[model samples]
Target: MASSWDNRVAFVVRYLYDIDCNGYLDAHDFHCLALRSCVLEGKGECSKARLQKYQHIMLSLWEEIAQLADFDKDGIVTVDEFKQAVMNCCVGRRYEDFPQAMRAFIESNFRLIDLNNDGILALEEYRYDCVQRIVVEDIKIIDEAYYSLLNDDDRRRGGITLTRYQELFAQFLGDQSDDCPAKHLFGPLEL
Candidate 1:
């Protein structure tokens, strides 16, 4: 029971990631990840302890913005809202919001990602090469619903500037924007 529950928790975390649980690189998987993580709780495999940590991380990472699908204020993450968030994050030119993040913060984050000393990217790395632009009002608009629920320290590293905030946002956005094959939670469809 515990292991199965852990896998589900991890699955929510995976969905919260830039990629899906199976590591497929696309909005499809990312979105699927969000829904399961958020709205699909309390049904045997869903509960408080099951998703507490995952909620904390997601709020911190996404800057507490409420995705369209995240109708409920719970932090676990929902597939529809997750997909909506991913689409909003990636629908820019070369991830235009990257530059909005703080320079030093972005540089430090880059070092952590470029671990192999190679200019190329690798797996499990969540850094963005593009600069994205996020309107403060727009961010506020999106987060209006779930703002207070994510105010706890469980989801943040204290205070983050607008630029530093944008940097993290862009990295997370780019992480799931790929062309990989999809993985199905309902099991694979028969041909």
Candidate 2:
């Protein structure tokens, strides 16, 4: 039985990874996410080689997730399976204890979001990368959420670097506290 916190985390994961909104995560969802990334990068901006790399990374991520979460050995992962995997692998674990697949997924996602490849996520980059993908009722809400991910120092620095994002990602997954700002990493939580 998953706690409400687990459910909330699962909701965030499904919101991001379930690209088709079909309630199950499959290879096609990852493929669509890769296509979205290419589109975000724009046609000629991504180049054929870069597009191939994105596709490969997304597919590999899907493979890793499926291996961990697809308990039925089916091609798709249900929200329940995702929640269970989260409970087993993330909750109560330190960031350093996370599985390689989880770390790879995080790094790959960060790379995909860093459109300029500058190793930092500026506000505009975060806005374009996140807002375009999430279906939010109010755009302002997303802006607020983005700001919440940054501390005063991070704001002063002008952007979040990959290291900051990694720490936040770990918090979002492993922290049991409701006050964690990383809970807003994707967007507002229903809880």
Candidate 3:
């Protein structure tokens, strides 16, 4: 009953979000909010104040991203719903297209990476805080994918402004193919 494009979307979605290596994209990918608790406990390199900010930002990202597959609004994306969302995207019903959904996801991610809240993200922030934070074995691929979203001149500029970040994010979410470097975040792709 599924078309080739739908299958491709499913494959890409699985390849990009199955953080547990268990072929599923559920709330577990958010790591049970341990990162939040760690920050609250001052258990990381960032100061309590900075981590506090990250806590809110990360939570928002988790909620928005998870909602993409939470068809029933139950706060969890069952494997079935996850597959359905991918199929839906193939038909031009992308969850990322929703303004509120995309805004919340992007804003939270930018805020989390922009620890200084200076409205700009330094290269270190993009490389370490943003890319490194991804729970994947081959971070190099994620790094490549992220940088690929920017122009060479932009990369050379040494930092990304909020506007540039939005552009990069749009490119990232718009591409759903296996070669879309951002797909490396969940791990390597088989197709």
Candidate 4:
């Protein structure tokens, strides 16, 4: 059985990957996400190359998920499959290469979120580009989550860089302590 923290992590993964909210993850969902990432969400038009890059990254992520989670050998992954796979492959630390696989996904997502190409995710960018796209949580919660990832200096400077995001990402996945601020990385985990 999975722990509450593992369940929460699985919920977040399902929430993010199930683009259509269809209750299952499939190639079409990943394809839609890739397209959405390339669309002009107030970030201006994405180049053909960039679109292709996003497609490649999302599809690669899909492949990894399928390999790890698609236990039925079917093309789609159900909620149960997702939960079990997340426990085994992620929080369980069963796969040694999982971190490297996740790094690619994280880096790609950071680039997608870092509009303006400034290498830093500004507050507005995080609110508009990242959080708004994922969930309709309150502004205060969103702001708090974003600010929690930053140190005093980084907060004063404006936003989190990719390095900082990577660290927070690690903490969010690996840390099980109640005091971990990264637990709010995708808003409050309903654990």
Using TM-score as the measure, what is the rank order of every candidate, best first? 2, 4, 3, 1
Per-model CA lDDT versus the true structure: 0.35, 0.76, 0.52, 0.71
lDDT, candidate 4, at 119:
85
| Model 3: how far residue 104 lies from native, Å | 1.2
Off-target runs (Cα >4 Å) in candidate 1 are 1-59, 65-69, 98-110, 116-191
Give candidate 4's error at residue 115 in angstroms: 2.0
Q: Write the per-residue lDDT of candidate 3 for residues 1-191, one digit (tens) a residue.
A: 12233343454345334545565555565553435434533435547566555455445545666766777886667557765654454233333464464455455656657767787776556666534334546657656645555566566765577667665444344444435433322223333
Please say which candidate is ahead in TM-score: 2 or 3: 2
Residue range with the least summed lDDT across 10 consecutive positions in model 3: 181-190
Report clash pairs, candidate 4: none
Root-mean-square deviation of every model: 18.3, 3.3, 6.4, 3.7
Winner of 1 and 4 under TM-score: 4
Clashes of each: 20, 0, 0, 0
Worst 10 residues of 4 by lDDT: 92-101
Residue 67, candidate 3: Cα error in Å is 6.6
What digit string (tens of lDDT, one per residue) describes model 4 on residues 14-118? 667888888899999889877877774336677888788778878888898898889999899998887677667665242233645556778777887777889
TM-score of each: 0.29, 0.80, 0.51, 0.79
